[model samples]
Target chain A: MRIAVDAMGGDYAPAQIVLGAVEAVRKYKCDIVLVGDEEKIKAELAKTGMANNPHLIIHHASEAIEMGEHPVEAIRHKKDASLVVATKLVKSGDCDGVLSAGSTGAATVAAKMFLKMIKGIDRPSIATPLPTTHGIALLLDSGAIVDSKPRDLTEMAMMGSIFSKYVYGIDNPKVGLLNIGEEETKGNKKVQATYPMLKQAKDVNFIGNIEGRDIPSGKADVVICDGFVGNIVLKFAEGLAVTLFQLIKDAIKNGGILAKLGAVLVMPALKKLGRRLDVSEYGGAPLLGVNGCCIICHGSSNAKAICSAIGVAIECVKNDVTGHIRDSIAEEELLANDSETI
Target chain B: MRIAVDAMGGDYAPAQIVLGAVEAVRKYKCDIVLVGDEEKIKAELAKTGMANNPHLIIHHASEAIEMGEHPVEAIRHKKDASLVVATKLVKSGDCDGVLSAGSTGAATVAAKMFLKMIKGIDRPSIATPLPTTHGIALLLDSGAIVDSKPRDLTEMAMMGSIFSKYVYGIDNPKVGLLNIGEEETKGNKKVQATYPMLKQAKDVNFIGNIEGRDIPSGKADVVICDGFVGNIVLKFAEGLAVTLFQLIKDAIKNGGILAKLGAVLVMPALKKLGRRLDVSEYGGAPLLGVNGCCIICHGSSNAKAICSAIGVAIECVKNDVTGHIRDSIAEEELLANDSETI
Candidate 1:
């Protein structure tokens, strides 16, 4: 299988992207088409000492979207942008999936505009795997489409459950509506309205409502919320982790000689803990509900992060997550028809 | 100032509550009336050795609201509940303020029902002071009211700003609308509509939009959002902190002998860090936009937490936050009338 990588996206851009692609080609044994400016991609490829690697390919794109550009405007105007070209490859079936560590808005826009939505899915969502005490839990609509309807939330629950089962291998994933309280009657009007719909959903293990505190507890395999709420939770967790880590560092630094000695001795253990909490280590979040696989990484991702993202892309394609979603949607329609006739 | 404490509220209930009230009376030289079952309050207070302290008084209440009961139903039915009676003490001008470490929903319901809303305030809000790297940042509407209107958001900003300046001593505090993006056009339809209204609000700094990431950074002194979003962010942060600290402890435990030794040496510094990140250390969040001071503590609060909450209640009463809010509302009306003439 071949995967297209947006070589010009993210803070590290062509260099890290190229290195990650070379690593992916060697490790995963999958063909990777590096899509970006030919000359810059070639320069970065040379540094990897795999410029002549047969498994690696380069698909040149003339334009690149900046991180600050308007997503829709950028995708519409930059016809040959690296992200656009990469997604186009997946749409054309030349590549099974696409990966990008760029402006999430831009990547989502490009994926929707090029790959389009899977049938029966009204909107696409970003399903991110958050690290928990026991395992990983998936939070969907993590800043894709906001102001989601009740039906839209039900769709997210279904798609997120599928992604968790097929991609993460969670069996009979418990899907919970992200709400203020555990009761079905809790949360805003939107989530309150969505609760009954999720409860009635077939093939999905609805676990009623789960609060924000439940996210990291791994109470549910999949947590569903509107993109607006999901995005805030994700980003706030990110920020709080950063601040807490910083506080620990400062405490150690100012704790006199004993603290410094302790820090040196516990460095390895702290590093291990950091890895467990690192967002990049889990690979990129998938922009689920699109026709083809599209993995969106953080814009500040390093080569390691990009490489991990490629692994996720491969997993999605191999497991045929998109196919399962399509089948599930079809089954859901059939169930709805039966209920209506009754 | 005399403060009323809900001695029958919280997991620790009368034991911690009575102890905290005694400590507060001694430390702050303020009066405290513990509202709960007479026998229970007397038994707990006797353990503190200052049972018959001149500044401490016990007011008997026949009922107590359990954490799991429906908030509105419990508050409406349990008229003689500890929390209800405590709030009544403030309403009757017998107590300067009321503090509770009970069900947040019940506390909010009791406060609203008894204390009522300040003039010109659409809805009351819980303004919580979150620990930041530099200092503290206040988050408002932290699960008080959901599906807030644009005008409600503006009111939150004004009340939050007043609370920050008077109680927290942050002069000219920067108030921000909590949204998904930094841009004015970002976030769901609710926040987007609230943006222009916040900008037009008077007596507020109105620093435009702040993303979830900005919260921990203390970029904005006051972060305003609907109660739903604010509550989620607050709870998520609490959960993440617990998970991370537990992870660190587990890492050290699993590591070899050297790691265990390092933990011993760094225990003090880690303890200090823990204290800094501890939400209980910062006292309780005040229920802003209420007619009287109402500080809400966590349901699991211990003696120290309850004492800190009492301190917060004292500060609110001493600074006359409720009176300031009343003045601010009056000034806002005069400004609105002037703007109409212009």
Candidate 2:
């Protein structure tokens, strides 16, 4: 299978992106198409010693979308841009999927505008794998749609469940609505309205309301919420982890000779712990409900992050997560109709 | 100053609460009134060698409010409850402050219904201390009100600033509005509406929008948000810390002989790190906007947590935080009118 990589994306641009694509092609044995300025991509490819790699190809583009630009407008106006062209490849089935470590908003808009959503899906959801005490937990609608209706939340839960089962290899993934309290009666009007709907959905393993504390424990395989709340939780968790690690480092450095010695002794364990908390280690976030696989990586992602993102793209395509979700949702809809008729 | 303690509150009940109250009276030189079943509190007090402490007093209560009970109804109906009596002591000016490691919702209601909010304050906010990279950060409205208006958020910021300045000992504590992005145009409708309002308020050190990721760095001295989002962030941080520590423990436990030896060598440093992240170590959350000092500890708090809660309560009263906030808001109102006239 072929995957289109946005070579102009991320903070490290052509160099890291190019090297990551080359490594992915060699390691995963998948055809890699690099989309960016041809001259720059070729230069970086030469540096990586993969200038003549048969599995790699280049698609030229002139303009690069800045992270600060408006998403929809950027996708529409910058049609020749690397991100736009790469997304088009997926839309046209020239590539199995598209991966980008660019502006998340830009990638999201491009995916929705070009690839479009599968039939019967009202909105697409973004799901990221969060490392928890039990294992990796899937947090969905991380920052896709800001305002969500009750039905929209139910749809996200269904989509998240299927994605976890296929991509993460979790069977009968427990889906929980993120709320302030574990009780169904807790939370604001939006959560209160969505609780019953989620409970009634036939296509998901519905667990009741899961509190914010439960997210880190992996209390539910699929933790679903509106984009606004979900985004805040995801970013907060990321920030807190980084802050704590920094604190630990500072304490070790400044806590006198004994502390420094202790730090030296435990450096390996701490390093491993840091790696476990890194978002890039789990790959990129998947934009569920789309017709084809689309992964959005962090804009500041390095070479390793980009490589992992490509791996994630391959897994999504191989598992047919989008197709499974579409069919499951369709079955649920048909069953609802039959019950109504009866 | 006299402080009322709910001796029947928290998971550890009379043992922890009674011991904490006796210790507070002896160490802090504050008069303590333990509110609970007289026999149980006295029995527990005897073990702590404080049965004859001159500052210790007992106010009998017949009932206890469960953690899951409805706050408003519980406060109104359970008049003889430990939490209710503690709140009443503050209302009647028999105590300078009230401390409880019980139902946060019930404590909030009791404080509002009995002690009442300070003049010119529309609503009360829950202010909890957050451990940050730089130092401590104060996060307000952690779960007092779920659905908040722009005006409510502005008030919360004002309250948080005052609390930080007085209790946290910061001269001009920077106040920020919590959002998903740092951009001025970021966040939901409430945040969008509240931004200019907070900027216009004369009482606060208003910083621009702060993303969720910046919170743990202590980017701002006071981070303000509506209770819904604030509560989610606070709980998520707590959960992540606990989960990470647990993972560390598991790794050390299962990593064979060499790893276990390394873990033992670093156990002291790890334990110190764990203590730094403990919510109980930060003291109880203060219910801002109340007329008198009222601190709400976690329902599962132990003796150490209860002691910290009492210390926080004394600090709040000594600094006269509620009075300072009320006066500052009044000054802001005057300045707003003056600006309008100009």
Candidate 3:
């Protein structure tokens, strides 16, 4: 299988992206088309001692999307941008999937423009894998459709559940709608309307409503919400984790000799704790419901994170995660019935 | 000033409530009218050695609202419920303010029923104090109006700003609308609509938009949002903090002898960290925009938390928080002018 990597994307782009692609080619046994300026890509690959590798191919793209540029305008105007070229490669069947740690909006726009949507899918979602006490919970629509309807949320549930089963190997992933309260009646207008749709969904392992508190406790395998809320939730958790860890580190460093000794003892466990909370090892967030398997990594992702993101691309492509989502949507015919109420 | 305390409310009930009231009475030299079952409150107060204290008075309340019961239904039927009687005390000028740790819904209903609304106010909001890197940030509409309009959010901004200035002693607290992005155009319908109102609110120290991630970093003193989003944000932060702390503890405990030693050294710092994050020391969430000061404590509030809640009541009352909110609303007449576009 072949995957397209947006080499120009991310903070440590070109170098990190090239390294990640090289590592993925070695481990996942997948060919990668490095979509960016050929000279920079070749130089990075040569530095990594993978210049002559048969599995790695360079595809030159002239333009690049600046991080702050508007996604729609960038995607439309900068046709030869690395992100746009990568998605086109997927659309043309030259690559099975694509991965980009670029601006989410740019990635989303380019993907939608070229790769288009899967059959029967109204809109796509970003499935962000969050670490829970038990395991990973797939949070969907993390930065996709901002103002989603009830039917759209249901679609997200179906897509997230299908993706989770294939990606995480959960036999019957529990599905839940993010609401204010555990009760079905609780939440805003869209949440209230979506509750019954999710509950009556025969394919969904509906576990009623899950509150924000239940998120860290692993109340559901798939927690679905609109992109607006999902983005805030993800960012908030990231910020909180950062703050708390800093607080702990400061506390330990200033605790004098005894504290320093204790810190030494707990260093291993602390490392383990860090790893357990690090969900990126699994892979970057996958933009679900799109025509192709497209994974989006964080902007500051390191070589390992990028490698894991490419791994996601490879696994999703092999498992036909996107195809399964389409099949689930087709099989359930949920969107058809859901739209009637709307 | 005499504040009414719901002696029968919260998980700890009369014991913690009585203890908190006694502590507040001693520290602040404020009279407290314990509103609940007279005999039970008297007994609890007697144990605390404040039974016949000149500043402590027992206001007989025949009924109590169960935590799980429908708030509106309970407020309607349980006429002599402690929460209702406490509000009536405020309304009748018998008390300057009231504090309840019972069901938030019950407290909301009782406050709305008896205390009514200040002139020019559209809706009341619950101001929940959250720990930030710098200091405490006041989050409003935490569990009040679940389905809030843009105007309700504007009112929350005004009320929260007023409360923050009085309670936290910030000269002019920066007011911000909680949003997915810092951009003015970024957010759901309510947030988008509320943005311009807050920005145009000359009376408020409006700071455009703040994402959830900005909350813990102390980006804004007053983080304003509709109640639904506010509640979820609060709960999510609470859950994340709990999960992270547990993970840290588990890591230390299971890290063999060395890790345990590190944990020991960090114990003092850990306690300080805990104290910093423990917002309850400041007070329970106060329901703002009400006609009078009404603080709502958590159900699991202990004596210390309740004491803080009462302190919030007294401070807000002393500073004329509700009146300032009224003046701000009256000053701007924002919603009335804002409705033209909507």
Top DockQ hit: 1
* Model 3 per-residue lDDT tens digits across residues A1-342: 999999999999989899988989899888999999999999999998989999999999998898889889999899899999999999999999889988988998888878888877888889999998889999988978888988889888888887788878998999988888887778888899999888887568999898889899899999988888888889888878777777778877777777767667768988998998886687799988888889999988888899898888877988888888878878677676778879
lDDT of each model, Cα atoms only?
0.89, 0.85, 0.86
lDDT of 3 by residue, B1-342 (tens): 999999999999989999999999999999999999988988888788777799999999999999899989999999999999999999999999999999998998888888888877777788899888889898888978878888888888777777877878888899988888778877778789888888877568998898878888889999887777788788888788788778888888788887787677767867877887887798888887778888999898999999888988889889998888777777666666777768
Local lDDT at B296 for model 3 = 92
Q: Which candidate ranks first by lDDT, i.e. highest?
A: 1
Per-prediction TM-score: 0.98, 0.96, 0.96
**lDDT (10s digit) by residue, model 2, range A1-342:** 999999998988988888888878877999999999999999999888889988999999998998889888888898798999999999889999999988988988888898888888888889988988767899889988777788889998998888888888988999999889988889988899999999889878998998888999889999988788888888887777677777777766656666666566666665687688777888889998888999998877888888888998999999998889879888988998999999
Candidate 1 stretches with Cα past 4 Å from truth are: none
lDDT of 2 by residue, B1-342 (tens): 888998888888989888777767766888999999999988887888888888999999999998889988988898899999888888888999999888888888898898888777888889989888777899888999888888888888888887888877898999988887888787777788889988888778888998788888788999888787788877887777678778887766665565666666656665787688777787788999988999988877887777788888888899888888878878877887898999
Query: Taking candidate 1, what TM-score does its chain B reach relative to the real chain B?
Result: 0.97
Task: State the fnat of model 2.
Answer: 0.49
Ordering by TM-score: 1, 3, 2
Give the chain A TM-score for each candidate. Answer: 0.97, 0.97, 0.96
Where's the lowest-lDDT run of ten residues in candidate 2 chain A?
Answer: A258-267
